[model samples]
Target: MEDSETHNLKRETIEQQYKTVRERTSNFNSYTSGGSHVMEYGSTSIKAEKIYLYQGFDPASVNFPPNELSHDTQMEAINQRDADILFLWHMYKNSEDGSKKKEILKQISETMRHRIHLDGSIDLIGTVLYGPAKGSVILNTIREPGLPLVDDWQCLKSMVRLFETHCGSLTQYGMKHMRAFANICNSDVSQSAMEEACVAACSSSHDPTQWHPSNHGYSA
Candidate 1:
């Protein structure tokens, strides 16, 4: 059911390509898609998991068979998780102390994407979502036909809060300086030296609420 309307597929591109199949040879031309969560042809209907041969799935293992149709929850979880991450990052970036902000930003992407499982375990793609990526309708985009309005956007504000707070300010613009920050971090400069450099260069703290770059000056 998921169609970006374009081929903007990601990690599960292959699986999503033909999530469900509809037999279309004789009598009834049935097509399967993630929406119905089943493969159908005329009168025949089968769960997506039932066709577990040569699709790269191990017959011994099963995904969330009981909740294949509810993967919208998983997508919601992803949005929430991303929002949480950005919140932490926003605080780190807006830290009053220059050295602390620089130190926190140096961690690699691996550390930034970390999440903990619901069962007290840890993994990058943790089980917190508690839903499988397969057999999802809105897993990537508007999978359900004409149901884009149904998408949960409660966290939309949280997702953009940081940007909104620093809009038109140098702090907002700092998001674009990712590579520059990375280069400085990798330049082997000592913490004291980096702080000194930031102090010398910025010379003032930014008030994210005020966007007069010329008047407020740059932030460290």
Candidate 2:
């Protein structure tokens, strides 16, 4: 026989509860692209159970947004056994606001305890892409510091080469860059012109010019 908790709940009750939570999270959809600020890639990388976007504090107060998961809502989620890992990402224009979001993260961590897995700054990248008033996804994962920084990723061929060569070492952030690069290169345009442009841009971005036709899996 199934466990008592599962046995007790009717099929209808489970479906209704799942529907409610899904509706609540759907508000923060991704931008025009496949995902939001590249963070949406988390759904693929971490096998996210539930993705929530923190859309700033509530209008009535300078805290978590009204639409966001409140203490009660979180407890409800827990009671329903909806999630195993809790992730939080703060997207802020400046360091001060980022600090405030950290406080919220702390609160959630304390309340949820071991269930909480990962939280951190979505970095200035989210702010740059989505503006200040936006929410970032959260999850638990160990991000190795100083992995690498992408200054100008406008170079598609170089990026593709990096993806091909360093596929093993590339982090989530690096993969996002690779996705963005592929998008640009695959856009409707002349292949020669785009490749030349990409090579030029890559050379400009990386000193000593890392772009070569051969390296990019293309024959001159």
Candidate 3:
């Protein structure tokens, strides 16, 4: 699952909401398998694992959390390879340099493959996580490159629950954003129908809600 706006909340407001989640969600433990940023859930902090870099690039370095794990501990747990879900960050549309962005993604995928090999056999459920406006663009682009992305509506629903359960203390403006996502879920629209509307919007030179998956298909 993914959350956050590029620039919609005041620093204080963001911190307040984050504090609420950390204080309330004490039962949930957030982990960043290959991520190296600080993340906290309740009193627990899970740090992303640090992997040896490939030409100075760490594919798992998308961002991570509040806890730090020692290198020996991380290495010992390599056989555990505890991830079942993978959420990738950002989008090409948000990138100022598309070529470099694509290169980074390519390296990330390669590095992940290498890590998996070292970790032994495993299975993963992967999704491209991003904001709503760029959702459609990201889904299509990632699929065109043969990488499966989560469906837009599915993504919105996941995001809505994330906000309600974890970030409910957000400011009024931030709450409005969460409500907007909830509205999308309640719309009960299909991807094909939304795609048609998007095409119509483009024909009229208007942009509607911006922002699918692969043949592996969702068993749901």
Candidate 4:
């Protein structure tokens, strides 16, 4: 019923298979100097890795195998398609006031619009808006870039700055209301309505003098 390789495979644990596979690259190591420029990163990341691999890695002088170009998941070509079209589809379906919907769309940045997806139901709007990279426009703002154990997400910087311009700057306690902010963002409220809500709820809690429009730039 079993040949030697088949018998061995049956007896082998997942840990053994993992170890066997990982041993191929056991000697691999990497090191990086800061970066090519003040705004750029060093050789340890994927884009830099691509460059090094394409040029043939020559750290010291030994030539290792170069990385082949990835041929992952070949599919229909799509160029410059809207990243998400369905974010507003549900809102449009439910709302009767056409002018108000257009006004809301005009106020949101084109970049932020691509992140929303309410495909399932109108009820799931809050959940989908806060999901994964979808939520990054707001949540990623609390931490700064290049900090230890934190991410550098500069894309959604405007949304956070808008928060500060209306709502006061957040403390540890105020940061707890991040979901509430996310909800406001998901809701089809006008920019003026959102600003009014932010100020009404958030302005009085903190000293107004400390929170400045300048601080949102993270230059401090």
Give Cα distance to truth, residue 219, candidate 2, Å. 19
Instruction: List runs of model 3 lying over 4 Å from the truth.
Output: 1-23, 27-88, 91-93, 121-220
Best by TM-score: 4
- Evaluate model 1: give its TM-score: 0.21
lDDT of 2 by residue, 1-220 (tens): 0111222222223333344444434323322222223123223432322221212222333232223333233222231232222333332223365667787666545434312210111222223333455412211122357733233344555545543232212222233334344443333334444445434333322322222323434310
> In model 4, which residue pairs have backbone atoms overlapping below 3 Å?
none
Model 2's lDDT to the true fold? 0.32
Best by lDDT: 4
Residue-level lDDT of model 1, residues 1-220, one tens digit each, is 3222222222223334344221111112221221223442443222232233323434333332321333222121223325545766887867887877776675424233222111111111111121234312121223346643223333222222222223222233233333333333333334444444333322333233334334434343
Q: Rank the candidates by TM-score, best first.
A: 4, 2, 1, 3
lDDT tens digits, residues 40-63, model 3?
455323222211221133334335
Task: Provide the overall lDDT of each model, using Cα atoms, as 2-decimal numbers.
Answer: 0.32, 0.32, 0.33, 0.37
Best of the two (1, 4) by TM-score: 4
Q: What's the CA RMSD for each of the models?
A: 20.9, 19.3, 21.3, 19.4
Better of 1 and 2 by TM-score: 2
The deviation in Å at residue 63 for candidate 2 is 34
Query: Between prediction 1 and prediction 3, which has the larger TM-score?
Result: 1
Q: Which of the two, 1 or 4, has more lDDT? A: 4
Off by more than 4 A, model 4: 1-159, 170-179, 216-220
